[model samples]
Target: MGTALGTRSASAVIGVEQSLPSDVVVDISGALTNLVADVFALYLKTKNFHWHMSGPHFRDYHLLLDEQADQVFAMVDAVAERCRKIGGQTIRSVGEVARRQRLKDSDVQELSPGAMLSELRADNVRLREFMLHAHALCERHEDVASASALENWIDEAEKRIWFLFECSRN
Candidate 1:
């Protein structure tokens, strides 16, 4: 299979002018898995925050969380599609995502607006690091499509981070 970005997985052997090597697929797959897992992790945090948020910013956060969820979910889909392109299988279960994802699991109960915002901001910043690494890997392979997707992901994530900290900036 192949990601929508036009990268496929097999085995990585970077030599010729035609066809990606099978071993190269393995290398790219490893990198893509990291990307996919990162998106899945961030996805859970946003959705969890959406469901369990409380306090003064409740309505505002609710709407923001929805937007965050949509963004992360779209990224997750792209990541999984990358897996397919690289001849790897996507991690399909929430349970798997929970186990595989590196983001923290917070108890959403009784969290204040400030608390939730802090958590989201931290998570997004961490995710941006992962995106940077993934983007670098994509570039290493000359996978322009994957790199471009990563750029978009970083831009969206940066906006969410700005939104989370908007109040504090004042």
Candidate 2:
């Protein structure tokens, strides 16, 4: 079957000279591509909240989300390139990202600081869950490099969740 990028198989493109089977590469790359999508979704939502922030804690909350957004955006390239490194194609368009992203977009006209942080915390929790599953998939396939990357990403997601949780507390 064709993959999301409309490619028949991951190894059909230029070979990356890996020992892993084509199916294994395809599975790991698919999981990583999904991570890239969720990362993009979360990054945009963080920026959206950052731009629309208001209230007494505006400065603190705004800066927090801005920093988080930057961190989240930094993961995209590495994840996408990881797919290529494993002989697979990553996301090619925003449409693919949107289609694969599991995070819900927040488009409410306005959101208070607490609501913003809480929503973000929930999303980050979900992101961490996704990463853990990807890590497990890597382990199952003996993809140590991808698993290592996922471990760091999982830690980053946990930190984001903790920060958002603490910030939202009264």
Q: Report the Cα lDDT for candidate 2.
A: 0.88
Candidate 2: 10-residue stretch with minimal lDDT: 1-10
Residues 76-125 of candidate 2: C-alpha lDDT, one tens digit per residue: 99999989888888999999999999999998997788998999999999
How well is each residue in 1-170 modelled by candidate 1, as lDDT tens digits?
35443655555443222235566566766777766777777777788878887776688888998888898888877777765665656676767766667778776467766777788899899888888887887787676666787899899989989998994353
Reference-based lDDT, residue 53, model 1 = 76
lDDT of the candidates, in the order given? 0.74, 0.88
Predict model 1's lDDT versus the native: 0.74
- RMSD per model, one decimal: 4.9, 5.9
As for model 1, its CA RMSD to the true structure in angstroms is 4.9
Residues forming the 10-long window of minimal summed lDDT in candidate 1: 11-20
